[model samples]
Target: MVIEGWGVNENIEMVDRVAHCANKLQGWGKRKRVKFKEDI
Candidate 1:
């Protein structure tokens, strides 16, 4: 039971990390798009 709980915690942490990365990428993309528009 303890092992199962630990596994669940690890999965949650992984998901959080992926979500954080995705948000960062999205923000970066938005900034790039805006810059491109201004350059045109």
Candidate 2:
């Protein structure tokens, strides 16, 4: 899910941050038996 027209550097950084958070949340959800509407 890319946002349009962001600067390259900012986009890369944001994607990295989002990916990290998604991974963390996925791990937490798995432990808690939570379901997400969509996979990241």
Q: After superposition, how far is residue 1 of candidate 1 from its true place, in Å?
A: 37
Cα lDDT tens digits, model 2, 1-40, are: 1232333456367677677667766667786664454443
> Which segments of model 1 are wrong by more than 4 Å?
1-12
Could you report the Cα RMSD, in angstroms, for every candidate shown?
10.4, 8.4
RMSD of 2: 8.4
Off by over 4 Å in 2: 1-12, 34-40
lDDT of 1 by residue, 1-40 (tens): 3333335445467666666666767777899999999999
**Candidate 1 weakest lDDT stretch, 10 residues:** 1-10
lDDT of 1: 0.66
What Cα-based lDDT does every candidate model obtain? 0.66, 0.56
